[model samples]
Target: MIARVFGASFVVTILSLVVAFLYAGWSGVALCAILGILEISLSFDNAVINATILERMSPMWQKIFLTVGILIAVVGMRLLFPLVIVWATAGLNPVDAMDLALNPPADGAATFADGSASYETLLTDAHPQIAAFGGMFLIMLFLDFVFDDSGVTWLSPIEGPLGRLGRLPGASTVVALAALVTAAQFAADDATVSVLTAGILGLFTYLVVNGLTGLIEQDEPDDSAGPSEAVKAVGKAGLFLFLYLEVLDASFSFDGVIGAFAITSDPILIALGLGFIGAMFVRSITVYMVRAGTLSEYRYLEHGAHWAIGALAVIMLVSVDENIEVPEIVTGLIGVAFIGAATLSSIWANRRDAARQSASPVAD
Candidate 1:
């Protein structure tokens, strides 16, 4: 099991180094290697969450996520997504945007040829809106989990009440909106439109994903699904889940992409280092978690993952403050701490359960 994990990391590191060296010599190789590790550390929670969803999926869908889905995640989200954002924010045509992206001007210089904004300025300038969107989306995710009307309670003191309140469908939205309002202050006054629009879109993304799932999975009135019907439903249901997973993956990757820029303004290197290589390892970790039944074995693992996400969402929102730069390692450690504590708790619970079972009367 460790070998599987190690092997994946090893292969990804090699690929990252090869790409990095080809691009910017040994320095690039070292930088990309660091970015790869950074990606893995920051996104460990993402892997856990992905595993929770992936384990329930059909084998074929699982493979799809591992293979084709990784490509989309790496190229589409990591590469094209950043470029598209630059184009839209900079208000440039495709060719000009591509040129600006490939050749960013010096800091504070015009990004566009006509002493206009450069890709780095435009991209970094777009951070507040990005943070707002990603932050709102993740907060909604955390809220939904805590507010679930389930009897289970990991952090009962807080989660129990939240679960009760979550019974009201509108509750999560309200909370997310409140978060947006607080985060909006971080955006430049002029960026009000961007922040609000992006934040709302984040909320809408969650709603649409849920709405689609409910639409497809809802039972028909006065009718029961037959075997064939059930089979078709199963396929459709997995598709909804796939959509959810992709959105979730996107949300998780948002901060990573932004952070990658801090390492290097070159989107190509960012794609190779954090996007491509890191994505491969993340997919591998998800598959490993699923196959290992880690969630089932350590029941609190999911809770830890969600909690890590909650922390991340908060950090991302507050990160608009230049004075408060949370170290990347700090972010990674937060998730690791949660998971580590949860693992210990799970072990204790398992042992106690075993003891109780042993003490109970044996059936003849």
Candidate 2:
């Protein structure tokens, strides 16, 4: 198992470096390595949550997630998506924007020829949007998990409709329509509007993927080793869990994708570095959860990761329109606290069970 894990990591690392070197020369390799380490460190809980969901999936879906899902995440999200946003909004010619990203601009330039802003400026400018999305996303997540009530909750106004709509086929269509309207509204000149569009894109992307994947696997059996009744219950739970994990992964990747602008805007490099390393870690952690059965054993770990995701989502959303901020370090610390507490609880539960068993008479 360790060998398999090591092999997967090594392959992903090599892919990241190859893409990095091809785009940035020798320096790119170093950049890729650094990004890989950073991503791996930041995404441990993401993997745990993913694994919990994956364990409840059929092997076919698992394979699709590892293969096709990774491609969409790495290439679609980290690389191509950003470039398309810049081209559409900034009015910069695609090739020029590509060149500017590959080679760093002169010491100080606010806007590229296409009128697209610098990565730093653009990302900094977009923070509010990121924050807003994060905030809304987290609020919804938390309220869904904690409240357990249909109405009178903290986010009753939005959550009530969203939860109901989210259960329907039309949610993705509504989001897409919203995105089109958002883009058209800023047809003249407004990077802020474009940023808003991007955030919506991320949100809709989650809904679309979750909805589609859920539909595809709706009829499949749950897991390989669990019981039939457990499978039915866990299958539904796993589907919801999978949806949450995917969104959580996207949320975690948001800042990193934006930060990659600072490293080099070469969309290819950005995609490769973030995609290979980030997706690899996500997959590894997902597999680790299934293989280890951590959720069943630890019990509260999923709760911890979800809570962390909820918090990060809130931080990102609230800051979308304002400068409200929370560091990633804080996010990690919060998750660790929850997991540690859960672990202690699990240990206590195990000991109690052991004592109960020992106290019972044996049929010798």
Candidate 3:
């Protein structure tokens, strides 16, 4: 099962090597291989979050997520999304953006028409917007979990209280916005407005998506009806899940795209290196978690991942400060630690359940 689940990793390793070899020879191939690992390390928590959402979807949507969604992840985000940023920030034409990507100049030369900031420099300037948007969106997700009293707790002391407060309507959104505003106040004077706007947009995006999903999913049937219920399952492939997954995936990739620039600002390399290989691994992990029923079996996995996401969100928010540099490794390690502890806790929980069942008073 593990081998089958991780098959995509093997395939991606070979593909990344081949693509890198063709693009930049042996040295480049080695770098690509390193990048593939880096991408996975940076996004292990992403797989957990993706699994949480993927489980809500039907089989058809799951397959679509693994296939078509990955392509969009590669082409749309890693490739074109940066170009869109360049266009929006630097006021460059599409052709000019494409040219800049294909042939990125040195540090000082990545430029707008007026040559104020280079392309990469322009991208760095936009990090606050990306951070604000992705951070608020993600922090809201964490808050939603913590706010819900019914859910199992991983960090009960912290989470249990938060979950109780969640009884207040819109508590999560309010908290998230307050955090955003707090971060915005410390932002660069020139960037304060954009940061706030982007943070609000993130909050708005979450509300719209969550509200729309509820509306569409109100009529959907339960998944427990067994295989005889293919009709009901097929109907579950509504646009809401697709949109939700795409937005969720986008939030997950925000850091990777920015961090990719750290490794190599060449957009094409970023596309092939992080986009293809890293994304494929994430898809595979999502599928594996679903097939294994990881969430159901290990109750607190979702909670831990959400907490890790919250940390990531805060890290991103604080990163807007000029002096801050949250290493990619630090982000990855924080998530991995949370997930590892949760896994151990789940194992202990299973053992306790087993012992309780074994020691139950028997019918004579």
What lDDT would each prediction earn against the true structure?
A: 0.79, 0.61, 0.81
- Top-lDDT candidate index: 3
lDDT leaderboard ranking: 3, 1, 2
Model 2 residue 189 lDDT?
45
Name model 1 segments beyond 4 Å from true.
Answer: 1-12, 106-116, 218-234, 320-324, 361-364
- TM-score, model 2 to reference: 0.71
For each candidate in turn, the TM-score is 0.88, 0.71, 0.92
- Root-mean-square deviation (CA) per prediction: 3.6, 7.0, 2.6
Q: How displaced is residue 14 in candidate 3, in Å?
A: 1.8
Please give, for residues 241-330, the per-residue lDDT of candidate 2 as tens digits.
Answer: 455555666666776677565555556666666788767776877776777677788765665665666656545554443334456567
Best by TM-score: 3
- Against the hidden true structure, what lDDT does model 1 obtain? 0.79
Indicate the TM-score of model 1.
0.88
Which window of ten consecutive residues has the lowest lDDT sum in model 2? 146-155
Arrange candidates, best TM-score first: 3, 1, 2
